[model samples]
Target: MVFNRKHIENLILVTVLTTFSGQIYLSPTGGTFRLSMAVAVLTVALIHFRKLPVMLVCGTVAVTIPLFRSVVDYFSVLDADFGDIFRSYLPVVSFYISYGFLFLLLSIREKLSHPLSFILSLWLCDSFSNILEFSLRQLISPANIVSDVLIQIILMGLARSVLTYFLYNTTLYYIERYDRSYQENRYREMIMFISSLKSELFFLQKSIVDIENTMKDSYDLYRHLESGPQKEQVLSIAKNIHEIKKDYYRVASGLEKVLSAEEDRSSLSSREIFDLIRENYQKLSTNRQLHIHFEFHCRTPFVTAEYYPLISVLNNLIINAVEAIQQYGRIVVEGRLEGSIYRFSVTDNGQGIRPEDLELLFIPGYSTKYDTVTGRMSTGIGLCHAQEIVENHFGGNIHAESDPELGRTTFCVMIPFDRLQEVFIP
Candidate 1:
């Protein structure tokens, strides 16, 4: 609840309103002010609460008195007396409450540029209801008020349903369109990151190779010496150079592994994924700490894929998860199957993605980190590549859920096991 800002803002607004209630009542424009308060409350409730329908219901109840009076005054429903105007206006108050609540609910769940169309629709519904009432009064003066109200309610509900259907589809279309742009930007970022990492590895390899050649020359000189104090010094120097060469060889070996893994990264399978992660993280112990917890919940044969590419998927995810933590942190990996669908998840306990940041998390070059801190080298390609591998390579889906306060985030990947295996075998 604390992580939700919308809810917190709603609470603060409600508290301030409570404190100023008396002042509002005494003001000349108090009646209008109260109506404004009613609208404000409904908007706050709709935006803040996930249970929008329930909030809408509460808003309806709170404004019932004013709405009922609004209609009563308009129709002269009550006996023509001192308080009769307020009574006649009651129905308008009710209409306003119901109409505002529904409009707010639709606007939030289904994004709209303006409330004009929604307001127009409500007006149409109210007009239709009034027409029905006027028609009933003319045809049958003996009819009960309960039956009339029920008919009006049913008709208005149907109109709301029709409008909701149209609005919902429009919102979904806009969301999907926005997501596509997000993915394209993410792809560009990931590609740039991969390129930079490749270049860094190449430079390290060249340096190590230069050191290796110097050591080889020194060893050759030491091999041709006579026995003396100089011989002993030469021997010691030779040993030292051997050790240095060995260390250089090790670094070169690690670089070779990174490069090899990069080759044909589009193909990899379940067990290969484990091997790739283990091998990569095993070498990078100087600057980063990586912890992997893998769970296998399905007792089935390994699903096959393009071996290297699949490795890239796991490799990219693990790297990003580690980087996100920025310090000592754990990366939890889990795998399972639901019928023929395979699910793989990686979770990290880190400074999780912020709410505003979440929408652009996958976008390219949109890092929240300072370039110096992250070495200005990260192209943010890992996640975008991971997403691509899941969706395009394996025909799967990838999604992320995060809680910044808890410092935790999880990425879920769903793939069709049978189809992937068939492609691999074929």
Candidate 2:
């Protein structure tokens, strides 16, 4: 309906199949032209009104042939037996009616957007049946125009259907490819905006450092002034400026790399990772009481992954798990090593997922969080980006298992030793 590449192809396939119906002839130019015009008009109308009800409309419109053909005969303009010509096309008319009924039923029951593709395919298969019937009739008696034309029409219909298959699939491929390209471009633009903001913050810090150094030089020169009563006032002013500079430097240093987690050069042992988790748990504000527990069984010396991203992923997962819990509950983090792979799992006793909402969880800009007062909107890009990092950047896999009724959920991630190969940034 949106006329995407796939939809356009479906339209073309329908047009081709409809055109095949016009190849059946009654021996004269006028009769063939009239029949072709009727089928062509019907095909155009069907393309516009693509719904179950439209199929019935096509059959009703076909009834115009009898009424209009009678009027044409009154003028004696055409040179064929009108009655024989009508009977000759009666099989095609019956086939069209049956096709409409079958297609309408399937469309309504399946809620399909383009049901005619399958129906047209099935109808084309009837060509072989039509061919066999024509052969048996010709063996018993002399072949008539109706039988000969029916065989040819059936063969043409089969060929058209085969062509439809190739065209439709190719169109769908291009449509999906275009959709992915547009999305990737948008993602790159967003990353560029974030990087620019980081550069600005870095420059602002440098300017603050310069101002502090200038104030220090001014204070040092004032201290060397010859003995005078205003010396104390100058000393007090200088001290005040020095204290202000100290406070500014303290605040700026605390904020250094606030948006990112601390990086550790040494590979993290299981004990070190557990200690870091406990330290973070104790440092949480008084308003939140998050009970963190872990069960690490890995005997490996050290893992290849950096500590911060691993910690950041776990930190965010814990925070979200805590938020989802309406009351106090346990959050479990477990780690294990199997062969050359490391597996980490987090489990929470929190509000879980709805069956229908599962598929949408990892989609960018889709969130289930509701505002406390207005219950309005939230952009759910956090989990989406986190999953992207784990899968695309870390070459690991993450899976969620949730139970809404029981108020429990578990997220599992598996990282192979070969994840070092995924270190390159894109």
Candidate 3:
């Protein structure tokens, strides 16, 4: 499989940790017990990580080993001369440097994806590092360069290669299984959320219809009342009716937002989607006493797509624009077709986003609005949810540009027409 930069970095980190864990010091010869484990770790790392990180990890391990040994020796009661201690460390230093360069060379020459290629690369590097360490030891002590020592190095190299081959594959198997389970759980949660949204929409639509009828009757009775002593009472009742109507409208609008979370499987015109958003926001602005203007321009109106998500994204942008303005501002929405992409933009004249905060706006649970009295976030998921719907469901991308000095911000979304075509045609 192809590996990305993140995957490569993880592999390097894993190799470094495994190397530290597998270390075992052999007495008398001053060699490490599982030096072959480093070969196995390097083999796995080369398959995933790039040469740069591999080299860096090797350098890190080389430095860390000496420091670790120093700490251990300081605490232990092993009495040895400074010269002997330095002599013992020489072979380790030589082995690490040789391993790094030899691994780099083998990686450049071979494709490490296949097991055989990885094994061959690992064996070649391990053998060379071991030979270099043995030669270094010979220089440190004349009697160390014997036939018996050479044979032991060759035999150890073969054993390490065989051990690494088995261990790496076993570890890879468990990692893949864990990742697969995580993805499946995430998918299930999304499905359940959509199902719950559908049930809520049905009840909300029924309640909205009933409230609208009641509001119409109240208006008719208020208009027919005569101006007399009972006129004040009729007026009071009329005011209560208006207040109730506004409250129900607010409730209906909120329900529509919940409905928008589900996938819209119908073919809806761009105008239809825009009108729905405008009507919803108009009620909100009227209730809140905020002056906001909305404009939509779309030449090609009909498009086959999920209506709820599209409207939801536009609705969120408009809400954010409205909230940005402390007193009053204008919001303009424009939709146009350019080549094979549908471009939609929401532009506003409000307190524009801070330069530092602009990049973090779409992150989940991040909000700029806070209640003055309670010091709590007003809403945190608006932009995050909008971004997910556009990019994940509609195969689109969204970006924002802001001028804080002028109090102007514009958010733009671009979705490929091909994605819409696929849904509509099939």
Candidate 4:
């Protein structure tokens, strides 16, 4: 709209393109008067880029087309000079210049919303401009006019007007479709992003609950040792726990505020949840194991409001499977609804859990992972946290089965449909 350097460059492009369209013309009865797709090209250009000066484009085309054709014509005849026979194409110059101004005077661009009015106005401009060309040609050559030629000219204008309208509509249709696809993909990404944030909020709330319980136990200890030598130490421990509880409360409050806007999002689909999970761990897998591949399946459509704990539980199991594998492995996650319960299983072809340690898998501070480089023990609470969320939040059960002979471990979780999906069932 500013008529900057970009607009000047675009104007030059429209000028060259319109002149090229005019060059591809056909003479009806072996005369200099020509019919071409120049009008259609011009109309489309004006419709698409409203900031391009319409008059400047059309007037420039009028000069460039004849000048280019005259030079070509002059070269065709070796005896002709620069000025010879260029006047014969003068009618075309009048034709396009008149077409440009008549287009503006008729308000063709503004009436486009009314299809019939726009086409009628367009037909008027093209037909009248051609008629002016024919009259000028008659004055220059003293030729006779036929009635059939006039009708053909008018119908050609109508045909080109209708064609231009379709061209514009088809272009608009594709643009709308592309915009719709882009918006749907962005919406999916947003839902997954909110799901991750909600998972973190669930952990913060659980930490606050644990801190509160610990503070109560510490105070009870101080009361029991009221007259003992360690009585003040017990009270000091209670006070320190009290301060930690307040910090946890501040963190929980901040996380709650961040999730406030997304609270209205009632549920999420099972397949979408798994897709997000697959995308997350697959990236982590590629960094450690080049040949690690993942596959996920959902037998029935499921939607649940308990997706925060759900994501946390699945992320723990999959990460455990990923870390258990040394270099190359396959991890498959499958979910299904059976009767009144939903079940999910994560199977991995990794180093299997030991037979004697199977019963100890859910115990807090119990793990088999040891980091040789750092000489440190794994925090060993991942499976315990996962179990707590499953059993406490969703009233579910989780367990593992090992086929040590074949080196595989599968952890399965079962939750009631009524508990996980009462708010949104799908």
Root-mean-square deviation (CA) per prediction = 20.4, 22.1, 20.7, 6.6
lDDT of 4 by residue, 141-247 (tens): 75555566688789988988898788778877888899997876676566556655655666667788898899899889888875776988888888999999899
Look at candidate 3 and tell me the lDDT of residue 360: 94
Clashing pairs in 2: none
What is the RMSD, in Å, between candidate 2 and the native fold over all Cα? 22.1
Best by TM-score: 4
* Top model number, lDDT: 4
Give TM per candidate.
0.35, 0.35, 0.50, 0.64
The CA lDDT at 110 in model 1 is 44
Model 4 earns a TM-score of 0.64
Per-residue lDDT over 351-420 for candidate 1, one digit per residue giving the tens place of the 0 to 100 score: 7988887777666566665455656657765576666567765789888889988999888888888655
Q: Cα lDDT of all candidates, in order?
A: 0.54, 0.54, 0.67, 0.82
lDDT of 3 at 184: 55
Cα error of candidate 1 at position 24, Å: 99
**Comparing 1 and 3 on TM-score, the stronger one:** 3
What is the TM-score of candidate 1? 0.35
TM-score-superior candidate, 1 or 4: 4
Write one digit per residue (lDDT tens) for candidate 2, span 13-117: 554444444444333223322223334334333534464245545455445444344445535655767676555444444444654554455442242245466
Report the C-alpha lDDT of model 3 over 1-426, residue by residue, as the tens digit: 456787667755764564565455333355422243555665555554444455666666666665555555545636745454544664666677778787777763355357677666667777778778767666766554367666666767776766777776686788889988777555434433443353344344445666667667666766787877566676676677668767867876886676565434445666656765676677788898887877777665656555545666776788888888776788889987788898889999998888999899998788989866799886677787677767867789999999999999999989887765423321
Quick one: how many clashes does candidate 3 have? 0
Q: Candidate 3: what lDDT?
A: 0.67
Count steric clashes of candidate 4.
0
